[model samples]
Target: MDLTVIWAFIIAFAVFAYVVMDGFDLGIGILFPTFAAGRERDRAMNSIAPVWDGNETWLVLGGGGLFAAFPLAYAVILPATYPLIIAMLLGLVFRGVAFEYRWRDPAHQKFWDMAFTGGSFVAALAQGMTLGALLQGIEVEGRAYAGSWWDWLTPYTLLTGLGTVAGYALLGSTWLIWKLDGEEQAHARKLAIRWGAATIVLMGAVSLYNISLNADYAARWLTAPEIYWVAPVPILTGIVAISMLRAILKERNSKPFWLGIALFFLGMSGLGVTIWPYAVPEALTIWDAAAPERSQIFMLVGVALTLPLIIGYTAWAYWVFRGKVADEGYH
Candidate 1:
């Protein structure tokens, strides 16, 4: 068996889980300013309060798995995108602090709310830019990053950053539509339509820009034989996009959120199609960067034991917290 390939899938699953689970809350933070103060804002916050911290577990798993199973990829990728990584981490930290203190320090809740919005925006933008930096291909020299400090700060990266922000905002809006009712839900539906349209446009822009970054990327999606395999991703994405809009317009609450998830899943699938086997784009294949077999087998054992437990608890938590958020909230 190819342990490296197995580990790569596990890591990819973890990252995708992180993006879907945490993306909505970060999106909420991005759209916080638009929410009416007091009840509306509080309900929006409460919708995610139960699961926000728990959602980050996947991020820890993804990053840790990378360090353990693909040390060379981690080592090279980190230096190549350190600035964006640092920004993302700091944003998460500040966002967490704001989430906690906003309630505790009600007198200064405004400040905390602003902090939350800013932090979420920065984190989402940095994450998208990090993906862009990778897609554009990292500068590597014999397993080490050979890029300049500002290599990640380009127009393409900025476009991707904005796209991610828009995508997350869509997630947030759809989540709100599902979890809130009355005026807030109506407002969220409006926001969802706007953000959804923006996300689709930006998704298209990013795709077009992505192909321009490398001939291989263009060939993978547009060339014959490969195109047959790749066609389903975008085709499904269009179908889901239409379904999501219909669900939102029809006021189907939960359907929109689920369809939004489908959109993200399809987006991730497209990304996988674009960069399979390669751990660092054209620079390093999974085999080139993976750790020894014994280490992987050991890690796989632990993952097998713990992964089920993580999924069980996460599912249970969401199930327990299901239904419309209360005005009083869990806090």
Candidate 2:
């Protein structure tokens, strides 16, 4: 079997896990200001307090796996989007700090609240823009990133960034609906309906804009053979969107969050379809950018031993913390 393909899937799984796990918390942070202060804010924060930090483990795994198993891809992609990467890291740092300090420093809670919202917004935007930059294609000349520093900043990237923000907000609102009770849950349901509609609109916009960015992308989704495989993605996405809205409007607590997750899954699957086999999108195939086979084999063994443990503990944490959150508890 090809170890490169295995490692590629492993890294993709890690990234998908990171986005699914962390996206909601960042969404909560984005919706923080809209939530009422005091008990409402505390309940929102508490809903994620138990699992938020653990969610980042997938990010570390994804990044480290790329560096170890596909060092060439890492080297090329990083320089091409350094500004977005830096902003994302800084935003994560500030968000983490605020997450920890907001409760301890009540006197400065307002400041920390702003910091949390700003950090989450910045991080989510940078992530989406980075994705847009990659989708639009990077300039690679002789195994090096050849693009200008600001190449990542474009109208398409901005749309993608905003779309991601809306997507995350939808996730956050659904999460709140699942985790809060009474007034908070009702408020969250309302937010979920609005954000859900906005997210679907923006998702469509981003997909169309992505197609416009490259004829290859257009062909991938529109041409005969490829279109046959890709056609189900949007259809499924539409189905999920309808189901999710119905759940929200009906005031079902848990279904909206799980359905939101399905939407993200379908979106990522579409992305994989769009850029499969290519590590740098029209620049380098995964094989061309992979590390030595010996290195991947070595790392696969380590991952095999440790990944189960990570999954085991993460699942256990969620199981232990299951159910609605109260303002006075869990934080």
Candidate 3:
């Protein structure tokens, strides 16, 4: 395989992992309020407390990989989307602090709860907006961003922000059903159905928007004769979505979260198929943005050795913490 392609897939996998893992926890925060208070809310927080930080490591890995493997793309895209990224980070800061402080001081619990939920919503929305802007296509000329800073605020991108909020809420709802019991689980089931339905609509709207705006992307992804032979990801996405919905309706506990991961993966896979070689869609190809071969070889070695360790530790942690969350959480 081409080294550039290999690097792209590596970064893509890290991102996919982050979106699926951290995505659920983030969703939990998104769905945290709606009738969740006191012990129930604490249980919701506890369910993700064990793995949330570790899950965020995947986001770091993805960004670092891009910076290392595709410096030019990182350099350009960052400046183009600096505000959204900063806002996302700020949201993350609130979330990370809320995780620790909420446990430390029960008297001020409501403040921390607000911070957590608001942070999750902001972070999810910001990230969604980033994806939206990317799909809308960045403006790059001579390997530099040439677009207005406001370019990220298009109508399509705004809808994407809303879509992701719904999507993440659905994921969180399923997780609650898995980790909690009785009434909490039932509330989550209802939330899942509502958010799941919204997500389906928003996804359709986004696809229609994508086709309406980016003719070339649409042709490559859906309309062209070769699309049948190219990527089956979008089709698989429907199956995952249906499976998750069914799992929720059937009250299948753990199945809902796993199916949520599958749904997120299939969606990311569809996006990947649409923007393969382009590190910064419509801006730079992976080849155009890659670092020197020596850097690639060195980093590839480091990545190969480290990934298994990350995976192992992550698996071990989850195994140790398996089963329903209780009042104590991990502490």
Candidate 4:
């Protein structure tokens, strides 16, 4: 395989890793405003505190990989989706501040709590809008953005934005159910069921909107030979979603979190299959948007050297932090 092709997939994997790692934590934040106003919230925060910073490293990996390995696509897509991207960055900043300061200024905990929840909401929403805009297809002329600033907003994209929030909440809820005990755990279980149902409906809405948004949806999804390759996506997604629901119903702890992760991975895989080879989907092929071969090779070598350390430390941290969180919150 060509090195560039390998790099493209590598970048995709990094992005997926970010979503999977940071995703549940973001979900936790999304679920913060629920029955967690007191000790429950503290327990929830403790559940993720050890691993949250580490989880976001994958975002750096993905973004840095894109800039280094596919500068052209980065230049185009970033500029086109600048507003939402900025919103995402700002939200990240906001949440990070809230995380630390809430502990420091206990008197202002309420303000910080709202900040944390609001930040997560904005970040997740912006991410979904970016995905929707990308999938909806960027208008490029001469490989440059051809649309207005708000081109990222559309009825379909907004629906996807909401879906993303629900998805993260589900992820968070399941994680809470897994890592918490007693009242906190039970509360998370209830939210998991609610968010799980919302996820299904939103996913359906996204699927339905895809048909109207894409002229080729019928050919690509309904009758294309490629459909055979992707047929397992919906089937497996349904399986995980059902399994997640089942785990919650059975009052199982650990299984629900893993099932939620499976559901997310399956959804991401489906999207990847739908948009393979085309980094910009219908506009720029990976090869076209890739950096010069020398640059790609250099970065590939760097990633190869660095990724194992990342994987190892990630494993170590999770191990060190393993076991259930107590409702005492962060001390």
Candidate that scores best on lDDT: 1
Mark the 10 consecutive residues where model 1 has the least summed lDDT: 322-331
**What are the per-residue Cα lDDT tens digits for candidate 3 across 32-124?**
778557778888888887899999989999999999999999988888889999999999999989989988888998999899999999999
Tens-digit per-residue lDDT, 182-225, candidate 2? 99999999999999999999999988887888888899999999
TM-score for candidate 3, residues paired by index: 0.96
Screening candidate 2 with a backbone cut-off below 3 angstroms (N, C-alpha, C), the clashing residue pairs are: none
TM-score for model 1? 0.99
Q: Per-residue lDDT of 1-331 in model 1, one digit per residue for the tens?
A: 8899899999999999999999999999999999988999999999999999999999999999999999999999999899899999999999999999999999999999999999999999999999988888888897799989999889999998999999999999999999999999999999999999999999989888879888999999999999998999999999999999999999997999999989999998898888887889999999999999999999999999999999999999999999999888845
The per-prediction CA RMSD against the true structure, in angstroms, equals 0.8, 0.9, 1.4, 1.3
Q: How many angstroms is residue 176 displaced in model 4 relative to the true structure, after the best TM-score fit?
A: 0.5
Lowest-scoring 10 consecutive residues by lDDT in candidate 4? Answer: 215-224
Residue lDDT tens for model 4, 1-331: 6988998889888988887788788888888888547787888999998899899999999998898888888988998899999999998888889999999999999999989988889999998888998989888899787888888888878988998989889988988888888888888999999999998889878877876777665456666587887788889989888888999999998898888878878878877766777889888999999888888778778888999999999999999888898655566
Query: If ranked by lDDT, best first, what sequence of candidates would result?
Result: 1, 2, 4, 3
Sort all candidates by TM-score, best to worst: 1, 2, 4, 3
In model 1, which residue pairs have backbone atoms overlapping below 3 Å?
none
Q: What is the lDDT, from 0 to 100, of the residue 253 in candidate 1?
A: 74
Over all chains combined, what TM-score does candidate 2 have? Answer: 0.98
